[model samples]
Target: MKKSSKDSVVTAAILLFNSKGYSGTSIRDIADAAKVNTATIAYYFGNKEGLLEYCFTYFFEQYINKMEASFATIEKGAAICLKRVVADLLHYQWENIQLASFVYREMSIDSQMVREIMATYSLKEKYYLQKIFERGFEWNEFRPHSIPYLIIQLKGLLMMPFMNTHYMREVLYVFPNEKFFEQKYLKDLYQWIDKTLCSDIQIKKEAIIK
Candidate 1:
């Protein structure tokens, strides 16, 4: 299917943001790349900030859909669910670093933007993970700590490589764009996070202490 004008504009904005910072991206540039008039984008999205909001929503929707699909087959297995969640997160971060950078950049300084992200996508994302953890604990399958804190830690480690690609480039000689799914690279990190966050084996109601 042919891409929609709005999708084209958003993709162009992500590319622009990847090359230049957000402030450096202009509507005309997006328009030219998207092959739509600047007015077309403004009409579709209202303003640059509006275009950005759509970009955030688009990227986040894709991310969430991927996560949900990864766990779709396993409705009741907590360890499998956790593993798939981390795997989805690791894969998304590795594959979509440009979009992630756009988000992280906005989050660094724009209080309103950060609030908007939280109120919109972030809250639902957090709720999904928290529900996963709470359900895991309730089944006596895994221990539950603060779901928010565990999520923070799970998310931080998963996102750090993508967010700090420049620093990791200098320090560990880690190649961000290199084959991210190699067993020892992101996949290993995915398993390590799962092991760290979940139990060695699913336990019974008495054996497991939350």
Candidate 2:
């Protein structure tokens, strides 16, 4: 399907912002990348800040929808749900690395646009994770701990791989753009989640018995 002009602009903006950052990227850069005039971006999105806000909002809206769909189809168990959530998160981050990168960069700064996006979408994202954690607690699939801390850890796990791509390429010589690196990273992530957060077989059995 042919992408709309606005969609094209947003896609271009994501890449530019991810690579050059919010302050470094310009409206002309996005326009040139999108093969459209600057007025086109202005038409679709009022300004640079407006475009950034729309980009984040659109990304999270799609993310939430996908998460909801995954939750709906997955088996009714906390362990199963947790695994699916982690898998989905990993896949999404990998597929949308540019948007993920842009978001990670924006998160570190203090800006009204960032604040609004966080309050509007980031909080909702946190709530979804919290619900999963709550379910795990009730099912005894996860041990008791601070929900906020767990959320932070989970977000960090998901974001770190994409955020540290340069380090991975330079220090570890792992090119994330390669399928080999992506698969290996994802496998390691799954193992980390299983080891750190999941209940052992005996614990699950005891919980069931009780």
Candidate 3:
């Protein structure tokens, strides 16, 4: 699909902002990369800050929708649902590593704009995750744990690798840019989730039988 001019600008802005900090990137740079006039950016996004918000919103919307879609046909149980959600999220983050890195970098700075974006979209993401956890608990698929802690741990698991992609690539010899690395990482992540979150219902049943 041909990207719309607005999308083109936002895509260019993500790459530029990821490479160069927000303050370091200029509207002209985005315009040149996107092959649009500077005025087009101002017209579409009003300003650089607005463009940043739009970029966050665009990518996050895509993430949330994909997550929701992953759950659509999942009637098996919370374990299956959680597994699919985690897998989809990991794949999405890998696919949009630049955006993930940019968001993580901005989050570390704690700028007013970043805080605002977090307050808005991140809350929604948290809520969705909370619902998933709630379902897991209700279905007895997960052991009882602090919901906030679980959320934090899950977010850390998902974001840490991508946020530290450079370090992983350079120091750890983990080439996240390669398909094989992501596949292996995702497989291990799934195993970790199962071990950490999955309730030992069979064990409990065996104990009851005894």
Candidate 4:
């Protein structure tokens, strides 16, 4: 299938935004990379901020869709559902590393876009995660834990690699975009979920207490 001009522009914008901070990237750079003129970019996105909004919207829409799909398809306990959700998220970030990197970087700053995401997609994401945790608690698949704290940890684990790509590459000597890193990081993530979130001992303790 042929890619649309809008998609091209978006792709170029993500690349530029990932390489250069959002403040540093310009419409002209995206236009030149996308092989489209500035006028076309303006026609499609209206302005650079508009293009950024589209970028964020597109990323989160797809992101939430993937999360929803993962949650819906799982019929198992909360532990399994949580694992699937994180696994899907992990792979999605690897597959869309540029956009993932850019999105998380932008999320660190305070802005209208960030506020909008927090209200909409971010809240939705948290709701799904909270539901999974709540289900696990009800079914005794996971121990009782603070949902907000767990979510903060989960977000940190998921975002750290992509958010610190330069450090991963230069300081840690790990290339986040590589398949090797994905596999290793995913293994560690699963361990964290199992040990921290779904500890059998913890669950058994809660069960005994009840």
Candidate 2 lDDT trough over 10 residues, lowest sum? 73-82
* Cα lDDT tens digits for candidate 2, 30-91: 99999999999999999998998887777788777767766764347665766677778777
Q: What order do candidates take by lDDT, descending?
A: 4, 3, 2, 1
lDDT of each: 0.73, 0.78, 0.81, 0.87
Residue 108's lDDT within candidate 3 is 84
Candidate 4 lDDT, 43-104, residue by residue in tens = 99899999989878988998899899989954666777887888889899999999988988
**Pairs clashing within candidate 1:** none
Q: For model 1, how does the per-residue alpha-carbon lDDT over 1-210 read when each residue is reduced to its tens digit?
A: 999988788889888977877789899999999999999898899999888877777778887887777667457576667777777776676677778767766766757767877887787778677777877777655655777788887777667777767777899888776664333565666555455655545633224545
Weakest lDDT window of 10 consecutive positions for candidate 1: 200-209
Whole-model alpha-carbon lDDT for candidate 1 = 0.73
User: Candidate 3, residue 85: CA error in Å?
Assistant: 0.7
Give me the candidate number with maximum lDDT.
4
lDDT of 2 at 109: 86
Models 1 onward score TM values of 0.78, 0.86, 0.86, 0.91
**Residue runs of model 1 more than 4 Å from their true location after superposition:** 1-6, 33-36, 70-74, 181-183, 203-210
Q: Which residue pairs show collisions in model 4? A: none
